[model samples]
Target chain A: MNFLESIKVAVNCILQNKMRSILTMLGIIIGIGSVVAIVSVMQGGQQEMNKTLEKFGTNRLIIQLNWNEWDKITSRDYLTEGDIQAVREMGEDIVAVSPLINYGSTAKVGKEKEDLLIYGVSPEHILIENIEMVKGRFINDDDYKSKRAVIVIDEKLADKLFEEEEAVGKQIVITAGSQNNTVTICGIIKAQDSALGSIMEGNRSTVYMPITTVNKMFYDDYLYAMSVKVADSDKIDEVGQKIIDLLHRRHRNENKYIMQNLTQAIEQVNQFTSTFTLIIAVIAGISLFVGGIGIMNIMLVSVTERTREIGIRKSLGANRNDILIQFLIEAVIISLIGGILGMLLGISVAYMISSLAKWPPVFSIGNIILSFAITTMIGIIFGVYPAYKAAKLDPIEALRFE
Target chain B: MIKTKNLTKIYKNGSIEVKALVDVNLHIENGEFVAIMGPSGSGKSTLMNILGCLDRVTSGSYVLDGVDVSTMGDRELARIRNRKIGFVFQSFNLLPRITALHNVELPMIYSGISARKRRKKAELALEKVGLADRMHHKPNELSGGQRQRVAIARALVNNPAIILADEPTGNLDSHSGEEIMAIFQRLNKEGATIVLVTHERDIALHTRRIISFRDGSLVKDEPVTKPVDAVDMMAKLSDMKDKHNI
Candidate 1:
């Protein structure tokens, strides 16, 4: 028979028993649905993480003190002003280097005392970290040269201290290590919310001031950490390694400080997402395997039920290949129908959950195609035995079957 | 034409072997009406199965229309059965879901005939069996005699050279059985070779010859006189229909 004719017959047969055909397709539907939903959610999470990381400035690198076991005996090792100069001298690709010093202190604004970390850094640090100003100006180079005690307070602190009033040019008392320092607020900085809202929490109640003034008022030895920005994101790793080697030589043959690339952190996050997606996929594959077995069971039952029909066709000049093709077509049809419905249901569920929970759930065409291909293969592989049994049935015995 | 030499069939059940046919030699010419009569379990069905190419002989050479069917593959045998022979079962084995027209068209489908031609041939065959108006009715909706006529139409649709009937009238009433026997007689007179298996001696007497089987062997083959004219009986029924128009 021609292709259309064969398909017509197969469709007619399936339509004759609609309930049985739909029930047989249910296994594949569930399998594909779960796979699509899980994978889309994972893809959405990964995209969200990438967006958050991108908001942190792609070319930025964080330089913190390692202080591991091998460097425990090294005395007084920290990122200094000279190390920042050396990192700038390494290449014209380096954009800016800002040394940061932070101290936990109590700030008093008209008897409302709050414990907060005051971050002291050059005005260039604001530009490098992509920080935005809400009101007034940040500490300029003149403030760092003159060691002026001027600070920038976040919007949250501004709101708490002055209610709706402007807080710029106001003086606040900061007490740390028995030394009470009064600082003029030069600017009101807007809080930065990361793509995933992680950094927003950190910027809620912090303050920023000139690093030179912080050095004079706080501990006089060395700064806490240094943040570096590069001109191009692709050179972040190379420039970070050069800075690390310079810091190691500057620390007198001790590589006590740790250099971390933001790109690397992003990579770690991506790896975590990939691993999580793989685990979910493995579980989904197990369910699909069970679904394939269910198909095989149903197909075997169908073959037994249609023994006389097979015999009649065989007696009517249908070859073994014809019988095999017929049964395989039935199996593939079940899986194809199930797969399509499952994909629809899965995407709908994913969309519902994403909208309800405010989580990004990405619908990926690759995942849809992969699920369909795998289900089709499952149908063929699991359908072979039953089809063979039907094809190999004895014509005489089958015809004699009631 | 059909010929069989030393035709034997032995069925195996685990360790036991049951011989269903034993060295039966038979020849059937074209355009002949022949009947095989025997009691149940007398190997008549087995012989019919072998003749219908539904079963393979254990050791024999059977030739049909110059083809060595004894050694033919399953697919080749199926092809021959579709194109060269038609079968009528005692139960009128029409597919339950299909109407009489589709049932009649089934055999031609396997013969690779076009749908239009198969429909035309099935309609002609149904008309020949006097079921032209009942083509849309399913087998269950037809009477016993009408169902058998539909089965006969199905058997004749492909214009096969041979018609094999295995107890074709076993389930019908005596009047319907006689009507079916008359149709077979008219088909034989029109040069369609037929081999019928029946237990009724009266049915056997209507055929030109009768072959009797017993204990897996042919016991007797004899010619019978007083062969009936099926066309004349159909004409008589038509005359009765005309007279009953009051």
Candidate 2:
């Protein structure tokens, strides 16, 4: 018989035993469902990680003095503007270097005070951090050269301190240690909105002033750390090592500084995700294998139950090939239906979990197509033996069967 | 036309062999009505199986409608069975799940006939067997005789060379049996070739000739001097039934 006719016959037979057919398809459904769900969730998590890492700045490296030996540290171990100039003159790979000093202080307007974490940076900090401005402008060379009492604040702090009034061009008094100074708000930078960004920043209001201003007003100009931006990110670690070596030589000290970059962090996250994906894939494979076996077992039972029908058809005019095709089509249709249901289940589960965990949900056409192909292959692979057994039945014996 | 030369069938069960049919030579022409009569295990059913191409002979030749099918392979034998022979079994083997129309269409389906033409031919065959109104009923919904009629419609839908009935009336009541026999007789009168197997002498009397098998061999083959007309017999049965009711 033709393929369409065989499929029709198969469908009729399956419909005649509705519960049995669905039971046979259950293994495939669970198998494909877990695979799709796990894969989609993992992809969504990886995408979010990559986005956060990219925002953290891939090409930026932080060089910091090791503070564990604070009692043994000397004044000569501190990084200086001379060291920053030396590193900038080292090679073309170095984009910009700027000192970064953080201090916890309080800002005041009249008698009202709000706690703030203040950062002292140079003009190049804008390039290294990719800071986007909302109004006014970032710290410039002119502000650093003249030691202008000007500062930049984030939009959140601007909204909090000045309320509806513009915070830019306004002055806020800051108290640091036992020293206090008045600084004008030169600009307002955009606030971070990502889940990871918010967690890292917490509720601390942030304000940025020129390093010279902070060194002159708050403390002595003994730098503890510096941020460097490299042009070719592929060699970021190597360039970081070169700069550290140069600093250690210039300061005439050993093991006093360390370098950190985002590339290594990115690699660690990738490794973890890939390992998890591999484990999940193995589990999904086992499920599919078990499901395929279930289909085979059910198909064998169906073939045996329909032996008399096979005999009748054979006696009428059906060849072995006809009988084989009929049963094979039935098995394939069952698994395919299961696969479709499983994919839908997987997608919904992924979305549900994403919403609960606050990760982006991703669905790809390639994955759906792959699932279809795998299910079809599973059907053909598991169905052959049962269909062959049915086809090989002797017409006389089959007809004689009760 | 059907012919068998030195037809022999042996059943082998491990070390033991049962000779079902031995040295059976038979011939029946086109438009002939014949009956094969024998007791159980007399090799009559074996001969029927060989004639239907459901089994192969051990050491003999059989030709149906001018095709030498004794040595044919399983595939070629299946084709021969599809195109040349129609079988009506004692159990009225209509597929229980499908309607009578689809059961009649089964043979044409295997023969690769289009759906529209198969439906038309199945309907026509069912009409011929006087089951046109019951065409959509499942087998369990029909009486035993109507189911046999449906089986007969399925058998003849493809217009095969011969109709082989192995005790087609065996499952029915006397009235239904007579009705089945009358249909066979009418078909025979319309230039169709028919071969029936029955142990009942009354059923054999309706055919023009009788072939009797004994112990794996054909012992007798003779034409009936006077054949009983099944239509007349059925009419007599109904008349007697009516009188008894009164």
Candidate 3:
């Protein structure tokens, strides 16, 4: 019989037992449902993470004193002013370098105190961190050279300290250890808006000031970490190695510093997402296998129940292939219908969770197509044996069966 | 046309063997109506199965429409059954789920006929059996006589070389049985060859030729001097029932 005729026969047979057919498709529905929902949600979260990392700057590298060995560290082992000058003059591929000094301090405008991390940096820090300004301008060369007491606070900190009032050009007194310095805000930068920002840094606000002023006021010109920006991200590892080697020689310490590339962090995040997705996929695959077994069980029962009908069709001139194709198509249609329904269910569930969690819903056609391919293969693989059994039945014996 | 020479069938179950048929020789021309009559296990059913291309013989040759089908494989035999032979079972074997029209269309469907053509041919066949108005009703909605008519239409839809009916009226009342016999006789008179198997002597007397079997062997073969007319039989049956009315 022709394929269309087989499909018609299969559909009629399935319709005759609608409740049983739906029950047989349940396993496949749940399997594909969980797979699509989990994968889409995970992909959305991964994409958000990538965006946050991009905001941190993809071509930037951090070279810092090995903090794990802090007990054995000396002041002389710190990244010095001479080292910064040497890196600045190294090559055209080195875009910018700035020593970063993170000092945990509190700022007060009158009696309104806010917890903050004060980063002491040069004008190059803006380029290395890709800091965006909402108002005013970033620290200039004169601000660093003259050791000016100017600060750049993020919009979130500005909102907390000044609330509806202009924060730029205002003064807030910062207390560090036993000393206090009143600094004028020079600029307001955009606040980090990603959910990851709150997760990684908590609720503490951040502000930036000139490295000269910070060094003169607190650590007395000593620094532990430096941020470096490169012209090309692909050459970041090479440049970071060169800088670390230079810092080692300049400080006369072989194991004093380590280079951490931002690109490597991005790759690590992607690897982690892939591993998580793979683990979930394996669980879904197991469920799909169980569903295929369910299909096989139902198909075997159907063949047995319809033995006499098969005999009738064979007597009417249906060959072995015709009977085989009929049963096989029935199985495939059941799974395929399950696959489509599961896809819609999964997408709806993903969107529901995304709306509640405040993340964008991700929809990929490639993954959808792949789910279809997998379900079809499941149908064929599980359907073959039962169809073969039906095809090989003896017509006379089948006819005689009650 | 049907021809068989030393046709034999053996059924084997593990180490046990039963000879269902032995060296049966028979022939009937293209337009003849023949009856095979026997008791249960008398090899008449086995012989009908072989002739219908539903079973393979253990030895000897059986040819239908000049094709030697005894040595044919399953696929080739199925083709022959589709194109050259039609079967009517005692159960009226109309697929219960489909309408009378679709039941009649089944043989054509297996023969790879198109939908439009199959539908037209099925309608014509159903109309020929006087079931044109009940074409849309399922088998369960039909009476025993109408169901048998539907089966006959299904059998005749493909215009096969021969029609084989195995106890076609066994499940029907006398009135329905006469009606089924009348349809068969009408088709036989229209030049369609037919072979019917039955244990009822009265039913066998309607055919032109009778073949009897006993103990896996053909015991008698003879032409009826005067076959019973199904119309006349039905009229007399109705009069007898009416005269004995309570």
Candidate 4:
């Protein structure tokens, strides 16, 4: 018989016993569903993490000096003017260094006040931090040289304060404990789509000012942390080590500064996400294996149940090949239908899971096609024995079977 | 036409062997309506199985339509069964899941006939058996006579040259049995060779030839001078039943 005829016969048999066919398909449905759903959720979360990491500028290093309680003398371990000057004079791999002194302050627009992280840095800090301005301009070298009382606030935060007025030329009052001042908004910086505007999260957001103004406002001629930018990304590790050595020489404490390559740390997190996705996929694969066994069991039962039908077809001119094709086609069509249903189920469940976890849903057509191809393979692998048993049946005995 | 020379069939269960058919020689011409009558386990059914190409002969050669049966393989035998011989069974073995028309179309489907041609031929076969109006009904929905007619339609749909019917009327009442016999008679008159197996002498009396078997051997093979008319026999049998009731 031709393929179409065999398919027609197989479809007729499935229809004749609809409940059994559907029950058999349930195993495949759950198997493919769980596998694809877990993969999609992991991929979507990984993408969100990637967006967050991109907010950090390329080839940048952060040096924070908080060496636990072993170095408890704040004056000795903490950063100072000498260490700052030493880092800038280190090596050619180092492009620029910006000493940062942050003061947690509150900024008020009329009566609306919100707490914020107010950073004090040189004009080079804007380039090191990769701040993109949406309005006005970042702190220039002239602003730092003259110690201008000017600031650049996050665009989203400024928009919240002044709904109708443009924020670049506006002025806001700032307070830090007993210290108070007013600074003009020199620029409005746009935040990355999936990141918080400030490095630190709070009620307000980020604001940048000249390093001279912050040191004069709150410090006693010392500093805490600094951000260093590398001229070439490939030499970041070498440059970071040089800066650390320079800081250690100035402070006379080798273990005082903690240097972190933000880019490398982000890559490590990405690696962790991929490993996590693989581990879950293997667990899901076990379920699909069990489901394939379930399909084999049901197909064997169907072959036994339809022995007489096989005999009738044989008597009607069906050779062994024809009978084999009929049973084999029946098994494949069952799993194929189940595979399609599972694809729909998996995609929807992934979407629901991503939404609940506060991430965008990721749909992979390649993964979906792979799901289909795997199920088809499973169908053939599981179907062979049952179809062979049916094909090799003795026609006389089958016909005589009640 | 069918010719068997010293055909024997032995059923073996490990070391023990039982002979179902023993050295039987027989010849049947085309367009002949013949019946083999015997008690149960008398080798008539075994002979029918071999003649229908459903079983193998343990010894000797049987030839149907000029093809040697003993030397043919399973695939060739299956082809012969499909193209040359048709079978009708006692239980009216119509597939219960499908309509009468689809049941009739089963044989034609395996023969590689186009779908439209198969449908047309099935309709014609169903109409020939006077089941045209009931073509869409499942076997379970039809009466015993109608179901047997559907079986007969399936047997002839492939246009096989020889029809082997093993107790075709065994499951039916006299009224339905006579109707089945009438269809066989009409088909035989139209030049289709037929071989029927039955236990009832009354059923055997309607055929033109009678072959009687007992204890794995044929006792007699002879033609009837004048066959009994099935219509007349069925009416008389019903009248006899009525007389006994009174």
Candidate 5:
């Protein structure tokens, strides 16, 4: 018989027992569903992590002073101007370095006063931290060298202060413990929107001022943290090590500084998610394996149950191959249907999970195709034995079967 | 036309072998309606199985229409069965899930006939069996007589060389059995060859010839002095019932 005719027979058989067919499909559905769901969650989590990492700058490394007990007493474990200059001459690895100093300050603009974060950064901080401007310009080297009292306010702070009008070129007053410094709002950076960005920016409004101006106003030459940008992502760890080594040697201690980079963490995160996906896929695969056995069992039962019908078919001139193909196609159709249902359920489940986790969920066509292929393979692998048994049945014996 | 020479069948399981048939020689000309009658386990069913191409003879040669098929392989025998032989069973053997029309179309489906043509042939066959009005009903929805008619339609739709029936009326009431016999009689009169296996002497009397078997051996082969007209017989029985009511 032609394939279409055999498929029709198979489909008709399945339709005859709608409840049995659906029940037979449940195992495959769950197997494919869980696999797809886990893959989706892991894929979404990975993508979300990549975005967060990219938002925070994957090539940027943070260098912090890890003060020893002796150094803590004297408060002498910090990078100085001479160390920054030395690191600048290191290599292409150190593309740019931004010295950051954070402090809490009260800001007043036309009778509006609220606590805001005071930031001390160089002009290169704009590139290192992926900071985008909404309006006006960032602090230049001229402002830092001349000790100009200039600051950049984010759009949120601008909206808070001006309510509707622009805050560019406006005077912003920063008072920290009675030390007040009036600085011009030289630039307005775009406000953060993503959850990670919002958390990074925090509830406190942020205002950026030149490092020279902050150092003069705070009366301290010490730095809080330094943001180091690497030219190549692959060379981030090597470059970070070189900078740390230089600083350690220069300071005459090996444990005085700590370095953190997004590149290193990305590998760990990628490894974790891939392993997590693998583990979940394995668990789901076990269920699918059980499902395959279920198919085989049901197909055997079906062959036995329909033995007389098979005999009737054989008497009607069905070749061994015809009967085999009919049953094989029935199994394939069952699993394929289950696979389709599983994928839909899995995607919806993945979407729900990602939404609950507040992560961006992504769907891919490759995984859906993979699920289909796997389900079909499962159908064939499990279908062969039962079909063979049916084909080998003797016409007389089968016709006599009850 | 059917011919068998010393056709023997031995069914073996482990060390024990049962000789279901032994050197049974038989022949029936084209357009002949023949019946093989025996008690249960008398080798008649085995002879039918071999003649229908559902089984192979353990020894000797059997020829049908011009081809020797005694030693044919499973695949070849299946093809022969499809193209050259039709089988009717005691239980009607109609697939319960499908309509009568589809059941009738089953044989043609495996023979690679186009669906439209198959449907047409099946409808004609159903009409021949007097099941034209019940074509859309499933076996479960059909009476035993109607189901047997569907089986007969399925048998005829293939247009095979010989119709082989094993107890075709064994499960039916006398009236339904008479109806089934009447259809077979009609087909035989239309030049169809038929070979049937049955245990009923009355049923065997309806055929043109009777071949009796006992203890795995052919005991008798004789032409009927006068074959019963099944259609006339059924009509007479109904008329007798009308007379009894009066």
Candidate 6:
């Protein structure tokens, strides 16, 4: 008659066969549980990737020489000092422009000589890439103005060279082309731990020198690539486009260089992660479908088993609505219980996996609510037909059934 | 009051139509105690089913309390059955899992009575049938006689106008069957109309009248000269209990 009484009747019916009810609920539990766990793991992984990407200065725009159409011209031979000045003049929000000239050579500190890449860059290189100084000061404008041969080394490279002794302000010999040069270490950058930060760390091991000195010593006029920093992160794309146009006019060719925005890289990663999450959700949804079928099967069996009970109730004036409500409520209770238990199990598993593997596990309230709604819908959709059949049974025929 | 004119029930099985009730006309007034006696497959059970609203008559005009029940829909028929008639079955049909009290309270539940009031009424019904002490017992825990008593209490819980019983004592021992018949006789004396179906002529002798059926038709309808009073037997038993103190 009332909602509470109907629920009571449904609960009593379920409790009448505890083992059967539990066994039926197990299908739904596994279906919902696996879905939540997989999605959480994927979400955690995406967050971890975003964190790593953020470490590399999401606003930092890389202006590398584009060789997509001009395959004959290499990135290492195309960029020049004149291009850097033209990009700087485009806007005041253009905070820093560091021209890069890279050379692979052997570096000798004391008797330990290691083959490493040497980067000839300006003082603004540290600011643009968001690199942190671990031990000593970064190379300053005074060092670049005087054409000072100063360098910064990562913690790993510093350890290799100094071996427990301080390496700052010490000379390390670099043999590039036919000329051998000795550069003083200005600072030691920290070793990066996360995946994206480690990429910058690997780049940090190079010897840094004044762009003027590199132009004078190496190619007399060449620049390889440039990294730029913008004042406002929101205006990165506009600033990047201005730099590209300025470079195109200065170089007299738009196809020679490419502007790679860090924002686009982050967007790509987001898209990839979202698609992956959707795929996992669809796979998990299949299990819920199977669980729905299982509920239908179990409900059918229940209707058949309780035919006589139906007859007795019908003869006692229980109407079709009563019978339908009773069976439908039984189904919903089973699924709702399974869904709650599944959510707990899934979240716990996701937490455990993330903690054990050191991965980011994302738990969003939206996903939890969506999963719950879907499971309950599955229960109602699957439970209706069997309940209808039970309600429509002929009381005489049902009573006659053994 | 009940009246059926030319009642016919044909059960179709594929291409074959079996006439379960054939051209039966019967009239039962208020507070009448009538027993329908027949052998197996004689359509006495079919007649009981139609009278109980568990089955539809193939062709008939049956009126209960002046309402044309034969043409009513399933839902309306269910309502009528709930408000006006109670049923007792050969198998007892008590929900096995619930206590005797809950089984008796079930019909009142469908009537939308409050739980507290339903419990009180159910207790009174059980006490009326002398099962007050065994209110909490399940069907399995009760003996045959006690189970039938519980069923009778259940039937009386709604205070329906008519009690339709199809072989109510079929599964009981002779003593339990007599005990059940005694309860029925008392219920009849309390002005409830009753129609009982039985193959045993001795069980039929407890009612005021007997209606015999054969080949899906009523063959005879006659009054019994000496009907048994079940409440008198109960009173005599209590008297014997007082006298057997030696």
Q: Which candidate should be chosen as best, given DockQ against the real structure?
A: 5
Every candidate's DockQ is: 0.38, 0.71, 0.74, 0.64, 0.84, 0.53
Q: Write the per-residue lDDT of candidate 3 for residues A7-77, one digit (tens) a residue.
A: 88888888888999888888898889888988888778877777677777778988899988889899889
> Per-prediction TM-score, please?
0.76, 0.89, 0.87, 0.89, 0.92, 0.78
- Model 4 earns a TM-score of 0.89
lDDT of 1 by residue, A1-402 (tens): 334445566677778878887777777788788878877876776677666565555688878787565437354576667777888777887888888778777788888886667778887887577677899998899999899989888787888888888799898999868989999999988775443544333433567888899888886757757888888888778778778788888887655777776678668877987887788678777877877888788889888988987776666556677788788777777778789998998998888877754567998778878877887898799888898999889877887888
lDDT of 6 by residue, A1-402 (tens): 446666887788788888887778776788788878878887776676676666556678888777576566755447777778877776678888898767667788778888676667788887776577888887788987887777777788889988899989899888768888888888988765564443544534555567766666676666667888889999988888788777777666656667787678778877987887788667677877777888888889989999999999999998898889888877888788778888888888888887765775778899889878987887799999999999999999888889
DockQ of 6: 0.53
Give lDDT: candidate 4, residue A211: 82
Q: Where does candidate 3 stray beyond 4 Å?
A: A69-80, A91-93, A101-120, A130-137, A146-198, A201-222, A231-242, A248-256, A352-358, B14-17
lDDT tens readout by residue for model 6, B7-28:
9999899999899899999999
Q: Mark the regions of model 4 whose C-alpha exceeds 4 Å error after superposition.
A: A5-23, A66-73, A80-92, A100-121, A129-131, A162-165, A173-181, A195-208, A211-222, A231-235, A262-271, B233-246
Candidate 6 chain A lowest-lDDT run of ten: A195-204
Off by over 4 Å in 6: A16-19, A47-55, A64-83, A91-95, A99-225, A230-259, A356-359, B231-246
Model 5 lDDT per residue over A168-258, tens place: 8889788967777788888898775454444555667777888888888888777757888889988888888898899888878667777
Error of 6 at B168 (Å): 0.9
Ranking by TM-score: 5, 4, 2, 3, 6, 1
lDDT of 2 by residue, A157-179 (tens): 78778889978899999987887
lDDT of candidate 4 over A42-137, digit per residue (tens)? 777767666655666777888878556544655777887666667777767667788887878888889998778888988888778768889999
**Which candidate would rank higher by lDDT, 1 or 2?**
2
- Scored by CA lDDT, what does every candidate get? 0.81, 0.88, 0.90, 0.83, 0.86, 0.83
Clashing pairs in 3: none
**Steric clash pairs (candidate 4):** none
